[model samples]
Target: MMPAKYYLFTDGSVNPQSKVGFGAFLLISDLAISLPEAKKLVETVSFENTSSSKLELQTLLWVLAKLDAVATEVIVYTDSQNIIGLPGRRIRFEKNNYISKNGKQIANAQLYQEFYKLTDRIQCSFVKIKGHKRSLDKDGIDRFFTLVDRASRNALRNS
Candidate 1:
């Protein structure tokens, strides 16, 4: 028998200093994925990195790791379009430098590269949302993301 269909709500935030964080609230109702399974999948991914942007991307990738080979549909919501846009375009990271087709060096190559890899897995679509919105759903997501964001920033600052 088929497992089940699941909808994933994900959000990420990053400070200018390159600190990044990602949070995912999986909706595991009868129409969504199983919470226990999803949580287990998320636990398998590590968040040790130099930047929060990478953390955010890692969170999304973590979601992919949880899916059990069942054809589950995932919808990811994020506030960081700059990072999410990496895979949508023709971009590459070489020698820790983000290089364009013209060999122009882009900033945050590591984050982009990780996001690039995260974007390669599973059936997922990213939607950019306005951060700190007053809506309840958006606000709750913001709270979690803020924690991840601050944690990332503090870690980077201390390092």
Candidate 2:
């Protein structure tokens, strides 16, 4: 029997007027899910004085927390290089306690710490997806990613 499939596509954008970052993610169990269906699964949040990286991490933590009690795995798709690069930087982050050589905390160190802990406690992986692209594929990966990207950028458009 095949295990249930889990896929999460995420994106984050900062509001220029308020510097409030908005992040959105869509989690689903079916690869054939449509954009309208995926929209129902999308979640959004805003954080004041936040960067895109922090927003990305926060959204990740949000989805991580949404998982059931059994510590199920998830495959995350995102446009953020920061999220795509975490695995390569985990060693340095752990070695230096999430600090830089300048004796200061790395940007979003706290969020990264929490994300690291949660990730270690669960099984997860990351997939890099193109953002704001005008291309579509037969697999629908691009469709879901495009939906998430728009959601993050438009979440607080009126504010």
Cα lDDT computed for each candidate against the true fold = 0.50, 0.80
> How badly does each model clash, as a count of residue pairs?
4, 0
Per-residue CA lDDT of model 1 for 49-146, tens digit only, reads 33545556666656666563653565565666664575555333544356766766665565456555544654566666566655466454444333
Q: Give the C-alpha miss distance for residue 65 in model 1, angstroms.
A: 1.9
Clashing pairs in 2: none
Residues 1-159 of candidate 2 have per-residue lDDT tens digits of 434447888888886667798888887877876678788888787778877777788888887876745446788998889988987898999999887999998988878888787878767888988766657442488788888888887886745
TM-score of every candidate: 0.51, 0.88
What lDDT does model 2 reach? 0.80
Q: What is candidate 1's CA lDDT for residue 121?
A: 50
Model 1's lDDT to the true fold? 0.50
